[model samples]
Target: LLETYCKASGQRINHEKSSIFFSEGCPQVRRDEVKQILNVHNESLSERYLGMPTDVGQSKMGTFKYLRDRVWEKVR
Candidate 1:
Protein backbone atom coordinates (compact mmCIF):
# COMPACT_ATOMS: atom_id res chain seq x y z
CA LEU A 1 0.00 0.00 0.00
CA LEU A 2 2.74 2.46 0.95
CA GLU A 3 4.78 1.44 -2.06
CA THR A 4 1.88 2.34 -4.34
CA TYR A 5 1.49 5.67 -2.61
CA CYS A 6 5.15 6.41 -2.96
CA LYS A 7 5.02 5.64 -6.65
CA ALA A 8 1.95 7.80 -7.26
CA SER A 9 3.21 10.75 -5.16
CA GLY A 10 6.77 10.47 -6.42
CA GLN A 11 7.90 10.16 -2.82
CA ARG A 12 10.58 7.70 -1.82
CA ILE A 13 10.41 5.54 1.27
CA ASN A 14 13.50 3.95 2.70
CA HIS A 15 12.38 0.75 4.32
CA GLU A 16 15.58 0.39 6.30
CA LYS A 17 15.15 3.85 7.82
CA SER A 18 11.41 3.51 8.39
CA SER A 19 9.87 2.64 11.74
CA ILE A 20 6.30 1.75 12.74
CA PHE A 21 4.94 2.73 16.15
CA PHE A 22 2.06 0.47 17.11
CA SER A 23 -0.45 1.09 19.89
CA GLU A 24 0.30 -0.40 23.31
CA GLY A 25 -2.31 -3.15 23.04
CA CYS A 26 -1.36 -4.14 19.49
CA PRO A 27 -0.74 -7.89 19.36
CA GLN A 28 2.81 -9.04 18.93
CA VAL A 29 1.78 -11.30 16.07
CA ARG A 30 0.21 -8.40 14.21
CA ARG A 31 3.22 -6.25 14.85
CA ASP A 32 5.49 -8.96 13.56
CA GLU A 33 3.37 -9.37 10.42
CA VAL A 34 3.41 -5.63 9.70
CA LYS A 35 7.14 -5.41 10.31
CA GLN A 36 7.69 -8.25 7.93
CA ILE A 37 5.41 -6.81 5.25
CA LEU A 38 6.79 -3.26 5.41
CA ASN A 39 10.36 -4.27 6.12
CA VAL A 40 10.53 -1.57 8.80
CA HIS A 41 11.45 -1.98 12.39
CA ASN A 42 8.89 -1.62 15.18
CA GLU A 43 9.51 1.50 17.23
CA SER A 44 9.15 1.68 20.99
CA LEU A 45 7.44 4.39 23.01
CA SER A 46 10.86 5.85 23.80
CA GLU A 47 11.04 7.07 20.21
CA ARG A 48 9.45 10.52 20.18
CA TYR A 49 9.80 13.89 18.51
CA LEU A 50 9.92 17.40 20.01
CA GLY A 51 9.11 15.99 23.47
CA MET A 52 5.77 14.60 22.27
CA PRO A 53 4.75 11.00 22.71
CA THR A 54 5.24 8.44 19.95
CA ASP A 55 2.92 5.66 21.08
CA VAL A 56 -0.85 6.22 21.07
CA GLY A 57 -2.70 3.76 23.28
CA GLN A 58 -6.39 3.35 24.16
CA SER A 59 -5.97 6.09 26.81
CA LYS A 60 -6.23 9.35 24.93
CA MET A 61 -4.37 11.17 27.70
CA GLY A 62 -1.15 9.33 27.01
CA THR A 63 -1.21 10.45 23.39
CA PHE A 64 -1.86 14.10 24.17
CA LYS A 65 0.19 14.37 27.40
CA TYR A 66 2.24 17.25 26.05
CA LEU A 67 -0.87 19.34 25.46
CA ARG A 68 -1.95 19.01 29.11
CA ASP A 69 1.37 20.34 30.34
CA ARG A 70 1.28 23.16 27.84
CA VAL A 71 -2.24 24.10 28.87
CA TRP A 72 -1.27 24.14 32.53
CA GLU A 73 1.74 26.26 31.71
CA LYS A 74 -0.48 28.79 30.01
CA VAL A 75 -2.89 28.91 32.96
CA ARG A 76 -0.10 29.77 35.39
Candidate 2:
Protein backbone atom coordinates (compact mmCIF):
# COMPACT_ATOMS: atom_id res chain seq x y z
CA LEU A 1 0.00 0.00 0.00
CA LEU A 2 2.83 2.42 0.81
CA GLU A 3 4.61 1.52 -2.36
CA THR A 4 1.42 2.03 -4.36
CA TYR A 5 0.84 5.42 -2.76
CA CYS A 6 4.40 6.52 -3.41
CA LYS A 7 4.15 5.38 -6.99
CA ALA A 8 0.92 7.22 -7.56
CA SER A 9 2.24 10.41 -5.97
CA GLY A 10 5.71 10.25 -7.55
CA GLN A 11 7.21 10.32 -4.06
CA ARG A 12 9.90 7.92 -2.91
CA ILE A 13 10.24 6.80 0.69
CA ASN A 14 13.72 6.25 2.02
CA HIS A 15 13.30 2.96 3.85
CA GLU A 16 16.83 3.09 5.18
CA LYS A 17 16.05 6.22 7.20
CA SER A 18 12.57 5.04 8.25
CA SER A 19 11.86 3.10 11.44
CA ILE A 20 9.05 1.45 13.41
CA PHE A 21 8.52 2.19 17.09
CA PHE A 22 6.52 -0.29 19.14
CA SER A 23 4.53 0.46 22.26
CA GLU A 24 5.80 -0.68 25.67
CA GLY A 25 3.38 -3.61 25.89
CA CYS A 26 3.66 -4.68 22.26
CA PRO A 27 4.84 -8.26 21.76
CA GLN A 28 8.27 -8.71 20.25
CA VAL A 29 6.97 -11.06 17.60
CA ARG A 30 4.32 -8.56 16.50
CA ARG A 31 6.91 -5.78 16.44
CA ASP A 32 9.20 -7.89 14.33
CA GLU A 33 6.37 -8.68 11.92
CA VAL A 34 5.54 -4.98 11.57
CA LYS A 35 9.19 -4.11 10.97
CA GLN A 36 9.43 -6.75 8.28
CA ILE A 37 6.22 -5.64 6.62
CA LEU A 38 7.25 -1.98 6.66
CA ASN A 39 10.83 -2.80 5.59
CA VAL A 40 12.05 -0.55 8.42
CA HIS A 41 14.15 -1.13 11.50
CA ASN A 42 13.11 -0.89 15.14
CA GLU A 43 13.69 2.37 16.99
CA SER A 44 13.98 2.96 20.72
CA LEU A 45 12.17 5.64 22.71
CA SER A 46 15.46 7.52 23.07
CA GLU A 47 15.39 8.30 19.37
CA ARG A 48 15.66 12.06 18.87
CA TYR A 49 14.15 14.50 16.42
CA LEU A 50 15.66 17.98 15.98
CA GLY A 51 17.80 17.27 19.06
CA MET A 52 14.84 16.36 21.29
CA PRO A 53 13.64 12.94 22.31
CA THR A 54 10.47 12.16 20.35
CA ASP A 55 8.91 9.64 22.68
CA VAL A 56 8.73 11.73 25.83
CA GLY A 57 5.23 12.19 27.21
CA GLN A 58 3.67 15.65 27.55
CA SER A 59 4.45 15.93 31.26
CA LYS A 60 8.05 14.71 31.03
CA MET A 61 10.33 17.68 31.40
CA GLY A 62 13.52 15.69 31.93
CA THR A 63 13.56 14.88 28.24
CA PHE A 64 13.67 18.58 27.51
CA LYS A 65 17.02 18.97 29.27
CA TYR A 66 18.72 19.02 25.94
CA LEU A 67 16.63 21.94 24.85
CA ARG A 68 17.39 23.72 28.09
CA ASP A 69 21.10 23.12 27.68
CA ARG A 70 20.98 24.51 24.18
CA VAL A 71 19.23 27.61 25.43
CA TRP A 72 21.76 28.09 28.21
CA GLU A 73 24.60 27.71 25.78
CA LYS A 74 23.12 30.35 23.57
CA VAL A 75 22.61 32.69 26.55
CA ARG A 76 26.25 32.50 27.59
- Cα lDDT listed for each candidate: 0.79, 0.81
**TM-score, each model?**
0.56, 0.61
- How many residue pairs collide in each prediction? 0, 0
Model 2 agreement with the true structure over 18-76: per-residue lDDT tens digits? 87777789998988888888888846555777766777877677878778888999999
lDDT of 1 by residue, 1-76 (tens): 8878998999998876667778779999999998898888846556566676665558987778779988999999
Cα misplacement distance, residue 12 of candidate 2 (Å): 1.1
Candidate 1 residue 18 C-alpha distance from true site, Å: 0.9
Q: Which ten residues in a row have the lowest lDDT in candidate 2?
A: 42-51
The lowest-lDDT stretch of 10 consecutive residues in candidate 1 is 42-51
Q: Pick the candidate with the highest TM-score.
A: 2
The list of candidate 2 runs beyond 4 A from truth reads 50-53, 58-76
